[model samples]
Target: MYLTSSRPDIVHTTCLCARYQAKPTENYLKEVKMIFCYLWGTINTGLWYTKDSGFELTGFSNAYYAGCKDTFKSTSDGAQFLGEKLVIWSSKKQDCTALSTAEA
Candidate 1:
């Protein structure tokens, strides 16, 4: 949870794993270890901000609809940026049958 602020790249995976924390299986354990291994391998990576760049606020979003398997729902992901820095991001399961970003 502490690393999410600094490591937006890993947030979605982390959250996905977290959803099964109440009843974690062997696969989840392996996935968690993989996340740790990935972090260790990229210990030197980080976002950098330059002083003279423009701070244009931009947002991007995408979503997918599978079917009526478990009610009408969609999986969506999005990121919002203030200038070049990420301000908000999320991967969500929403209660709608959305196929694309605009519909979601």
Candidate 2:
């Protein structure tokens, strides 16, 4: 969960694995290992911001209705940016069930 703040790319996969934390199977462990491997391979990768860049804030959001088969809950995700640099992001299951994408 902590890592997701800086590495948004792993948010979905990590959250999926997190759902199985109570009774993690081999597959869950494998998926976590894969995330670690990916991190190791991209240790030097990161976003950069230039001092002279334009100042702008932008946001994007999306949701999937009834995405979780176990709970029939929707998943919503969003990201915020300052110019070309990502400043915030999040991905989580919704509290209430969503019948459609718009509801989500």
Candidate 3:
């Protein structure tokens, strides 16, 4: 959890890696160990909230057309924030086809 929260740069890679966790090979285990070592070496790394930034809330939504090769379904993505904190995010496959980005 800490690793996922702290390392946004690796989120995509980690998610791909996690798909193999149910049947992880030796290489996958090695990569997991490396991530653990990185976390152990940088345990102090995390968000440091402050009070005086005069922050505001903002959000964004994005989607891709026909992201699933097998089903040809679209994918939707969203991210919301309060100040500089990331409050919510999601990536999911859409149930219907999107004619355009707007439709998605």
Candidate 4:
């Protein structure tokens, strides 16, 4: 949830990985363990919202065409922010295939 809320660009890949969370295979488990290891190695890393950071808001969004192999669904990604502080991010696969980028 943190990653999804802080970095929308990773949502497609994260959700794709999450789909296998219910019945994780050995490969998926290994990947998850690797993430844990990475987290352990980066324990000192942190995000800071400084007082000097102005409260300017900005956002960006994007999508990939047919990113899901199983569903052939287009993935949408977006992020919202207040000043330099990230407020929200999301990535989700659409229920229907988009005929074009405009349709999406």
Across 29-80, the per-residue lDDT of candidate 2 in tens digits comes to 9999999999999998877778876679999999978988889999988999
Top candidate on lDDT is 2
Candidate 2: 10-residue stretch with minimal lDDT? 46-55
Q: Higher-TM-score candidate among 2 and 3?
A: 2
lDDT of each: 0.77, 0.89, 0.68, 0.73
TM-score of each: 0.75, 0.90, 0.54, 0.74
In candidate 1, which residue pairs clash?
Answer: none
Model 1 lDDT tens row, 7-85: 8889777866776799889998999999999999999998787776568999998766642344556667799988877
Rank candidates by TM-score, best first: 2, 1, 4, 3
The clash count for each model shown is 0, 0, 0, 0
In model 2, the clashing pairs are none
Instruction: State the lDDT of candidate 4 residue by residue for 23-55, as single tens digits.
Output: 878987887677667667766665567788878
Model 2 score (lDDT): 0.89
Candidate 2, residue 91: Cα displacement in angstroms equals 0.6
Runs of candidate 1 with Cα error greater than 4 angstroms are: 66-73, 95-104
lDDT of 3 by residue, 1-104 (tens): 34565555445446545756788889888888887787788777766666664368899887777766556667776777778777666656787888776787
